[model samples]
Target: MPHTKFPQIIVFDVNETLLDITTLEPLFDRVFSDRRILREWFAQLILYSQTMTLSGIYIPFGDLGVGTLRMVADIHQVTIEESDIAELKERMSTMPAHPDVIPALTRLRDAGLRLVTLTNSASGASPTPMDKAGLSHFFERTFSVETTSKFKPSPETYHLVARELSVETSDLCLVACHLWDTIGAQAAGCHGAFLTRYGNAMLPAPGVPVPDLVASELTVLADQIIGRQ
Candidate 1:
């Protein structure tokens, strides 16, 4: 499909959209016995982040991650030790990028699109995950929701990116695997592209702002965007 318009700045969501977090399956299996708990843990991490935002409480994403892991462990009657938390954090900081990420990012950058990252990770973390993933060179900047003390899917988080870039919200496009994130960007008057990676799908709500582009992978989306140019 053709893009309606190309964005001046393409903002990326770091976690699963770009990085392959499946590498942690072994850790999850060792800790939770059921590797599926990794999915549950991540889902809870996002849920608690949003809940904290809605409740006017703000905590670093890393803190929320560890806390959510403990919560998930308790729910499953598993005992979680500090070592387990440390190990998880260590692995999280160094996830590898999805194989398609670097190529797609290069394609967009070669087309003169400004690329950047916007993640819910906190500022002052030892090593930003993108940098550890070796994908930092592809971006012009990396933003964290911690800077605004708000989690993503919040209008303020999306607005912060536009503000930092000194551009109108309409000139920014958020590319993410999360439908709520794209919906939030569109609601904030920015454009959005959805990467329909495995286990991710667009929302079926009639009135929600549909993404400007939707593709099965980042390379496909990049191709469409480049074609528009």
Candidate 2:
């Protein structure tokens, strides 16, 4: 297990880390199959997020999901019914937690660590995919950049999470699978840990402490937290 001084509060990035959205890849291949189509959907998702951030528009991530799905359908020249949309949402609504997620969160909760989630997903809609994954019970709070009308990699987004948790940014640690996110947190004055899922190369962030500590799985991170104590 890696090591870090214990943190009073830990803020996690949702989506790719805790909840495995890759489950959709198979379903997507069956429907749209083409790699180009999948890339298009992902690209549009990021485009829409940037659009919302720049235009001061705030649409729930759920709505964005549905809309992006429809856009992909259009791109693939396929048609979807309201029922299809509903079914797609149902599929996403119950995202599966990664194998390492629950055990790690269980340990963190048992250790009395304050766990919270900070995501770029929209809020006040259906429960987050994480909540649906049964990990919501482990977190003390769930926050989204939608509340601040900004996406991450922006200091404002990190600051918003700290503000919502009522912790000084330095008092919190940001755990994420993406280097951009870890760098953003550090720039925003929070400590960071990068879950280097596959030894991905870090982007251009110097002085980032090479992630402070690295873990391939959340369970290892939990052990690190415990070891620190």
Candidate 3:
């Protein structure tokens, strides 16, 4: 919508972008006596996932999520039980798709744009988050960094999608709520659409391009894409 060429595939970032991670706040409220720790815990999970990737180390995202929860608990000097960790894992897998997800996805698919998801989490766990949230039907495929053995913001992850889809990187567009995720795809030579969800916004910087399109609502983003068609 910013006078840009339309991409052949729209690759979605699953967590937070498609699904609502904030639903896990009650778990944090129970574990740390403050629900806001949810944000810190997720931030640590992302930080360490990328850290491990940069160090040439590979750890499954689910495992990293568990360890991150423990690390954050330690940082806050809050004791977390195995039950809590189990509950956290359960909640993570069971998080709901954001209310706008289905309609936007439906519109995009109906408009004949290819749709898929790329997540840092495993591509196909037994009942992956997409499956659990009932959003899998909207996507032609779902992808994960597992195949590349590299977490995102590392170009290899986005490259994997292009390879698997047999398309040039330029034919793909990464639609995401996180600036880091969008920037990573842009660096990999793909278009980026930033969904400015709550708790997220653009941070302009030199030498790094801004997202090709920015919209707060997924529906609006969908409309923009459809308009381009």
> Per-residue lDDT for 207 in model 1?
93
TM-score of each: 0.95, 0.80, 0.96
lDDT for model 1 comes to 0.87
Q: Residues 108-205, candidate 1: write the lDDT tens digits.
A: 99889999888998765546778787888889888999888999999999889899989878888899999989998888888888999877897798
Flag clash pairs in model 2.
Answer: none
**Clash totals for all models, in order?**
0, 0, 0
Q: What residue pairs are clashing in model 1?
A: none
lDDT value, residue 178 of candidate 2: 76
Q: RMSD in angstroms, all models? A: 2.2, 3.8, 1.8
Cα lDDT tens digits for candidate 3, 1-229: 2335689699999999999999999999988899999999888899999999999999999999999999999999989899998998889889999999999999999989999889998765568788889998888888889988999989999999999999988889999999999999998998899999988988867777798888999999999878866
lDDT of 2: 0.75
Highest lDDT scorer: 3
User: Model 3 Cα displacement at 64 (Å)?
Assistant: 0.6
Query: Candidate 3 at 119: error in angstroms?
Result: 0.4
Number of the predicted model whose TM-score against the real structure is largest: 3
